[model samples]
Target chain A: MLRRLIARWQGIVLALIGIVATVWLALTDQLSLYIHPGTSWFAIVMALIGAVLVIAAFALTPLEDDHQVASDASQPGPAVHLHEHDPTAPRSVGSGTIRAALAAAIIVGASLALLVLPPATLTSAAAAQRSINSETSTLDQDATALVGGDTSSFTVKDWAVLLGQSPDADFFAGRSIDLVGFVSSSPDDPDNVFYVTRFVVTHCAIDAQPVGVPVYLPGWAERFEPDQWVTASGAIVPNPGSSSAEPLLLTPDEISVTDQPEQPYVY
Target chain B: MSPPPAPLRPAPPKPSTRPRAAVGLSLGVALVLLFVAIRVLAPEAVGDVLSNSVQDFFTLSISVVIESLPFVFLGILLSIGVQVWLPDGFLLRHLPRNRVARRVTVSLLGVLLPVCECGNVPLARGLILRGLTVGESMTFLLAAPILNPVTIITTYQAFGWSDGILVSRILGGFVIANLIGWIYSRHPSPMSLLTPKFQASCAHAHDEVRASRTRRSVAMFDKETSAMLPALFVGSAVAGLIQVAVSRDVLVTLGQNPVLSVFALMALAFVVAICSNVDAFFILAFGSTFMPGAIVAFLVFGPMIDVKMLALMRTTFTAKTLVQLTVIVGLASAALGLAVNALA
Candidate 1:
């Protein structure tokens, strides 16, 4: 029965699991947590189409297919020709059973991962693993465009680019910045400084690149844990400390914990 | 949609089957509702049991799965259309009789169907079921991702003919795909290169089972997903785990060395497993640090093979075949990268 179920119903079960998860994510407005917002429609639409197909498959498929699958599953040789009904054939029952069990395990595992777990944004661990600020393409913007523009709407990625392009303190002398993102410690000065980090996703979380704006706050770890979402308002100042490598850092006038935004990753 | 594969009998499905269909429908609806309920009401703290990195690993893995699931469905739908609806031998009859010309034609099919590599696996399986030779299907599988219109346009948008990145990717992908096709076409028993179960599936696909197109399609969907999704989940998990385990700094530091940079980026490409359509933009962040050749290698090698691609392909190809495919594609991509670097 397990083998038969694995052969005939595993795909439908898995597809349904995926379809339900995707649609729920879409309904909840959290699909962007895993992928770019631009592609959410495509994912949701395809999922709906898949859901219909799964239902249609369930409703329209003849019982013969099920019976054929069961009979085929019972015949146990691994070779392609084993379906040709050779009673004397040596059956590889052990391997076939193992394969079926593995398939069953995959079905269970996929359900638990997709259906049971709460949706999440990538953490500081991902930021550190991909290494903060190592990626430049998504961060490659016209820093010059921000020179005289309103700086209130600038994201951490914008400031990161501006920091890279306009290194002089005068460019940022009077600009006050307000940014919101998860907290991650500066690699150089973990205690005194932490970065306001957001993943810049070009397509999906798989291609996400960590971008952060360093903030100078001594003993910040005592107040805020890594990956804690926070809102910070500050001035961009030249790094005040001698030990840090970053030329510029955000010296915040006010910082407090906040809820993670509806969309955490900046596309 | 076209005529069903076989229409000789065309007998209407019996009324007796309607009750069974009702049962199947209820079962399916019940399963879907159960999944939704589980997703909605499952304890939020269940995920917190895992540490941050572990949670991130699942997030990344789930992300890959969510991103690719739709494409995989689209692929399977297309596969079903190709196998059950399209007229038999319609695709094969038009191809050139000359083997090399046939492969050249096959590789360019991707330009028409722009689904990325993940989608290509099921479509390739469909083509094989529809009587395309395994070699030609292999050619389509490798060539389609890079040769597709979306990938080309994205590459163009990202690089804009700089350092010959766009031109090299297109030409290199074309050459490498045909090279694989040509080599595999000469195999003594090409069927041996496929997994036994997949080979059996091919044989069964040819058996001319008589059923309504709807029935056949659903049946095909069941079989295809059973084969494809397990591999996809496992592949996504491995990809996520590697992303959490490996340090990006180790790879980025090698970006300055022209030779090591090529291998390093290739390794990165293997692990990152981003879709081919957007990878040009993804890698552009590293464009300043890495040589053009390394980027070229990445563009060429990644769509054709990666942790995810390998798992998807493993459904259809044998372990030995995959190993050979990896080594050959790896070497060819490396050589292409090195040659481009030299020219630059």
Candidate 2:
């Protein structure tokens, strides 16, 4: 009875967990943590549809004797049916037990991950694994247009693109810049240089690529640890060190710890 | 004329099943409330207990589920519609009579139903049960993700006819899908390609006729969820684990090599398990570092086969068949990528 019940309801249970979690995230304005804001409406709308179907399913299918009624009413014959629901005639009792156990595990795992766990942005570990500033082509913009545009509202991504395209230090030498991002140490010059990084999400967090602008600061490790959010403002200058690959780096005049913003990624 | 009159027994009170619906509804409501309560009451500090990597594993896995869940629901709902609401043989009757032409028409069905690759699994399962040949269903599954409007538009937007990346992906996906379908169409027993359990499902689904459409739809929702969600969760977890374990530097380092870059990006595609609609933009991040061929390979290979896609497909196809499908698709995509690179 328990096996049949689980086999029948696991999906609906999972659907419920996902719907509740999604709706909650939407309500709290935290959906962007996982998916892009552009897709949030679609996710929310689908969740709502799934919720209605689930409720309708619950209201229509009686809890008790559903297997007997469903089988008899749907198809009258020898009880061959959906494989997951055929526990009574399993080829082996062990296999049936195993299937049931696996189903239960999925239910429990999904519930815990989706419901009980708190929502979070991708951490520094992901950033480190993906390697900050390695893939910034998505941040690419026309360099000439960037030089002529208003510079004060530019993001770290905007600056990173400029640094990549027009790295003629003369262009950035006198330009004061301000940016907010998590800190990740440079691979080549870990001791003196760290990057101010943020993930650029195209569709969802799964596709998020880390983009950062290098900041040259000696003894930076003593004050700021990796993954700590910071707001740094300074003038861009030619790289004084020979270790880092970047041609120009941000030499901050004012740098301080800051809170992680509501939307940690730039789309 | 009975030899003896038997005493009547109380019929066990019939168990009052009239209230069962109410009970079920109440339980569902209670479950939702319980989930919400747990979510609200869970400690924020609980996240801090785990190390960053462990935390990221959960975060990444959860995000995949959260991102793909709705599309999965949409697929199942559509599956229900196809099986229950549509008249019998509605889809099959409209297709071309010739086998190859039928398969071609089937592959183009993606233009109408633009569900992502993960969602296509259930829909394909539905099509097979609805009298679509196994080979044709396979074609639909593979081609739908690439040929769909959203994916094509996104690829266009990302590359804009540059270096033939967009053209290569579309043509590659279409040709590979058709080739697989044609190869499998000649099999003496194509049903052997499916898992025993799914075969059993196909067998019984054909005989079902007496139930009301509503009941059958509900039952299908239950059965499909039972089959699909477990696989989806497991697939998501695996995708997440691979991302954390595999270093992108290893792959990006090979981006400069014409031949190796094709394989490297294909490997990246297998691990990332990103949705097809947005993968072009995702791969655009590597546009500068990787050769156009590598980008093309990533675009072509990713939507059809990935860790998550394999897991979901496992629900229907046998392990041996999946291995074959992956190899063939991988080779075809690599060939397309290398050709584009040589020309460039």
The number of the candidate with the highest TM-score is 1
In candidate 1, what are the lDDT values of residues B252-319, reduced to their tens digit?
Answer: 89998989999999999999999999999889977688999999999999999999999999999988
Expressed as tens digits, the lDDT of each residue in B227-334 for candidate 2 is 788889999999999999999899989989999999999999999999999898888877788889889889989999999999999989988899999999999999
Poorly placed runs, candidate 1 (over 4 Å)? A62-73, A76-80, A83-91, B1-15
Local error of candidate 1 at residue A225 (angstroms): 1.0
Tell how far residue B334 is off in model 1, in angstroms.
Answer: 0.3
| Reference-based TM-score, model 2 | 0.93
Runs with alpha carbons beyond 4 Å of true place in candidate 2: A62-77, A80-90, A138-140, B1-17
lDDT tens readout by residue for model 1, A40-141 = 999999999998888987776553353344334445223325445544322467755776787788888888888999999898988887778776433557
What would the DockQ be for model 1?
0.55
Worst 10 residues of 2 chain A by lDDT: A68-77
lDDT value, residue A114 of candidate 2: 85
Query: Which 10 successive residues of model 1 chain B have the least lDDT summed?
Result: B1-10
User: Candidate 1, which CAPRI tier?
Assistant: medium
